[model samples]
Target: MYRYDDYDQRLVDERVAQFRDQTRRYLAGELSEDEFRPLRLQNGLYVQRHAPMLRIAVPYGLFSSAQLRTLADIARRYDRGYGHFTTRQNIQFNWPELAKVPEILAQLATVQMHAIQTSGNCIRNITSDAFAGVAADELIDPRPWCEILRQWSSFHPEFAHLPRKFKFAVNGAKEDRAVIQAHDIGLDVVKNDAGEIGFRVLVGGGLGRTPIIGEEIAAFVPWQHIVTYCESILRVYNLHGRRDNKYKARIKILVKALGIEEFRRQVEAEWAFHKNGPSTLTEAEVARVAAHFVDPAYESLPATDAGYASLLDENKPFAAWVKRNVRAHKVPGYASVTISLKKTGVPPGDITESQMELVADLADAYSYGEVRATHQQNLVLADVRQSDLFKVWQSLRDAGLATPNIGLLTDIISCPGGDYCALANAKSIPIANAIQERFDNLDYLYDIGEIELNISGCMNACGHHHVGHIGVLGVDKNGEEWYQVTIGGDQGNKAAIGKVIGPSFAAAEMPDVVTHLIETYIANRHEDERFVDTVRRIGIEPFKAHVYGNRQTEKKVAHA
Candidate 1:
């Protein structure tokens, strides 16, 4: 984790004071709701259904154990005993008192954390792969670059008020775990055939009502010009993006209207003016940022330890957890563990205050004193030793954080829909809970294999339902809450938006509908074929037919 310096601390401390005054005015009725909307939004405070919600940014999803402890304390003291981690790798406190939010921000500032640029029409949090530094398949560590961008994007005067909220993601690994294609500006840190570091820039990628996989804007932009190039793209968007309609104001809409080639031309034209400007990063600056993220003190040991092997052989539950929740680390005798927040009976990504404190303690005891938040609404101890795997598993299991399903169907990504959010069309948490209960059998989940099931309350796609293998979106049909299902969506290197499967169903039929899709996958799949691969092989027709029945009945319903 990058520690804040004097300048960073000063800026955040000043912002907290500013927001505190704004909050006081709003409460005193000196500022009307219309006047305070942007003021509160800039501070990551939202007026939700019942109370004010405060979103705190975990830049690139990285935080120290001490910072985690502070978050836990905030949850315990300020809001309810729990907070929800979001798909953007941020956390939300749903029941924070409006007057108490400034105090919350001040507390966060003490730990080198704040809510600036987390909301409003500005550059949002810069995210990346959670396993950036430790992943075995990683080519470059994205944390340093993400940090550099985090500094650059936060409170940038040029882009302070853009047409819409902007987002970007950087992926330094061959595997696209960060879901780069789903961001407004996706940067793939790469090396060319000539062995020079550069970026493969993808633009116009976003998933809201209008879902899109970004088009390649540039084949490669040299490492020195990454920031400048990003500036160029944002400049073009700020100048030409629509302000007439909020729904049509995103960069993706601009890219679609102008076409990729034209969009690229405009960006390139803007880049020419600032190609070698002050924003261009030097080798020394890059190295300076990179120095903060060097490898941890990993002990030299055999790839597989005897104690680890023995525990795997002796404990079946631990073995299952190891298979799904644990991942290979760059170090020989270490592993990255995903502490499952998707346990049964709990909402996805909702961690209790006690659970947060326990995780912080576990991170210090087993891994380093750092924990990571993943885009799938899970937490990761990115440097757990292989020898201590069993002990960590037991501790997590005791704390109800050890659900053996990581990439399985039960590990759902969902939004706090009508339960807390006023923007939601239906209740997302209940739907997610229903699905988790419906697929609680570990044996059945393992048999089904890796499935990305995402649920969104509305088309804002906070849950990224458009990219799920089985995407579920809540729709309002008449006065009833209906659920719409989509299939064949993926968020890997070959990202694609999900296709809708016929008409929407009542919320009561959601779990069965999902089951029908999974059963269809199992029946149609070849040996060892994953659910997503099977969906790609056989289109959504089979699943749709199974869920909705024949076209003749569909025609009757349309007539009726």
Candidate 2:
């Protein structure tokens, strides 16, 4: 709910005008594709297979009802009446005409939103936990820090064009919902023994070709110096990160080339110069930013609502939905509800124009007029009152957004692969749909427990396949599409990249392969064990054998 002031409004307006002029020049043949590539990419415009894709940044995944309506309008007028929510909490319009992008950006500016830094080799949107301020286990509201970074990084000339793109995530809760360890820079808000607030910084973590978990660069950076510490890390990376080869350009490669100790030393040396400089945040500034993220007007109510309890007792469907889509809130009378966008037949994260308006209306009526997008490509009503849970669920169910499969196997994270992205070797949406159809049974999915199945068209890892419990990567085998599988990846504080499990299979063979993997997990699991936990404990060999040993069985399962 941060409102833009005159300065913020001016900046966005000027950016829109600037891009409009650039677009005009490009259209008039004054700039070649090579010349305009970086310019357009910096504004979040990518030329996909069929058309130009525009990624709109939703900072920290927060949106007001008005902004949601604006997005819906843009989708209906400028796009194909739908938008794809991404793992970074951004939204993508897959079929926007390159000529009309500036017009679309002008519309976005009216709502205080823009696509700046959503793409290209600059710091992208600063993300945080979807339940940042309201979660039961939150240590602090990370939205303030996320906003602070967004301000600091937006159009910052020093880091505008680095070796490669950069990402930053903040985890303010005990649960690592932000998946900080998978970002270029990760921050965990912490309180020291003396009760002073600070941050634990993790640097050089990414998930592309050479996936590596970040290392702790600073154990404790005081709140006032958080910006200074981040600046130091970015400065070190800007100067030392590889630039010759695009594949090795990320900061992770630089950190690997220089050991963590050396990287830490370099960052420390850089930090000493600006630790107490003008960039160091003051208490007043911190308070000013934090004020925007304060708790909503909560009513005085008992810890348990009678009506909510009665619904849980009486309605099995509602109970199941609460079990999966609802999360505990810090406030006793409130809950956070995840509106799943991954319906069985629909492409994961794709939301139609009508659905966006519906969510906006629901947010206004039930969630304090605000919505938060999760890194899992879903939307969150972060402050829903427990008393209104059934009503909110009913509205969401009517919109086909109440899938009740949060954290389940069918809640897949995927990218627009060969279907839209020219860089993709195989189609990701079809694979996700196939898997979702195969695992459509909610009861069976709940029994199977929490499983992250991510698919990417290529190794760009846009779908974060490397971090999923069940990771699928599409590869180009000769001229055909082959899918490779990986397991045991996790994206929490203890992040780990998955390992390849032998030869790749044809596209039609993926569902059966995934089923066998699930069957193997069920066979090997202990009481109430998660798929990832089981994989970590038992290793990938058992699942691999089950998938590869019985081709006839896999064929039968695939046909079924």
Candidate 3:
């Protein structure tokens, strides 16, 4: 993890004091709600359905054990005894008293954390693959690049208030775990055929009401110009993006209206001014950032540990956990372990204060005092030794964090929705809970195989429903909640937006509708085919036919 220097600490400390005084003024009647709106939003405070919610940014999802312990303490003392980790790799604490939020921010500052630019119309968090450095298939480490961007974008004067919020995701692995194609600016750190490092830039990718898969703006940009190129794209968006309607304000809408070629041309024109200017990075700058993310002290051991093998052969539960929640590490005897926050009773990505402390303790005990919040709404110990795998599994199982459902149907990604977010049209937590309850059987989940089912309270797509293999979106009809289904959406290199199956269904029908989609997939898929692959092969028609039987289809048509 990157430790804050004097300047970083001074900036954050000053911001906390500024917000504290602003909050006091608001409470003292010196500022009205309208006057304080931007003030609070810039500090990551939102007026939600029942109370204020505070979102804390975790840069590239990386945090130290000490930082985790501080977060746990803040949740325990200031708000409820829990917090929700989000798809953007941040955490939100619902039910924080408005007046107490400044105190929370001050506490976060002590651990080199803050909420600046987490909300309002500005560049949001910079995210990347959780297993950046250690993944077996990784080509480059994205942490340094993500950190450089994080520093560049925070409180940037020119982009302080763009048309809407912006996002960036960097991927350096063969597998796109960061889901770069779903971000406003997706950077794939790559090496050209001539063996020089650069970025494959994809601009205007986003998911909301109008989902879009980003088009390539530049096939390759040299490493020195990454920041300058990003600034160029944002400059174009700020100059031309719509401001009349909030729904049409994202960069994706502007890119679509102009077409990819025209969009690229505009970006190129803007980039020419700063291509090799002062913003261009030097070798020393990259190396300085990269030093913070170097490998931990790993032991030299055999690739396959005998104790790990014995446990896998003897214990069924342990073997199942290892199969689902563990991943290959680049080192010979090391592996990354994902602690499934998708346990049966727990909401996806929701961790209690006690559970947060447990993760901290385990990070210190097994990993190298580091943990990552994953895009799947899970927590990962990215450098656990293969020999210590059984002990890690036992501790997690006892804590109820080990559900052995990593890529299975039960590991859902969802948002707070109507439960907390005022912007949500319907509730998302209940639908996610219903689906988890419906698919509680581990054997059944394994049979279903690796599938992503995402639920969003509204089309803002906080849950990233547009990229799920099975997406459930909430809609409002006559002031009542209804759920819509989309299939064949996927992330990774072959990213695509999901298409709606048919008319929306009542909330009560969602669980069974999902069941029907799975059944249709089982009936049609060839041997060893995944759910998304099956949907792409057979199309959405079969799933729709199976979900909406003939008479129901007619009723749905009439309703539509």
Off by over 4 Å in 2: 552-560
Which residue pairs in model 3 clash with each other?
none
Query: Per-residue lDDT of 1-560 in model 1, one digit per residue for the tens?
Result: 79898999999999999999998998899999999999999999898999999999999999999999999999999999998999989999999888899999999999999998889999999999999899999998889989999999998999989999999899999899999999999999999999999999999999999999999999899999999999999999999999999999999999999999999999999999999999999989888888889887889989999999998999899899999999999999899999989998799999999999999999899878999999999999999889999889989999999999999999999999889999999889899999999999999999999999999999999999999999999989886798888988999798999999988877777887888788788789999998889888988788888877643465587799
Residue 210 deviation, candidate 2, in Å? Answer: 0.9
RMSD of each: 2.3, 1.6, 2.2
Candidate 1's displacement at residue 85, Å, is 0.4
Model 2 TM-score on a 0 to 1 scale: 0.98
RMSD of candidate 1 to the truth, in angstroms, is 2.3
Each model's backbone clash number? 0, 0, 0
lDDT of 3 by residue, 1-560 (tens): 78898999999999999999999999999999999999999999999999999999999999999999999998899888998999999999998899899999999999999999999999999999989899999999999999999999988999999999999999999999898898899999999999999999998899998999988898899999999999999999999998888999999999999999999889899999989898999999999888998888889989999989999999999999999999999999889999999988677899999989999999999998999999889999999989899998988998899999999998999999998889999999999998899989999999989999999999899999999999999999999999998999999999999999999988878878888898999999899999999999889998888888943765688799
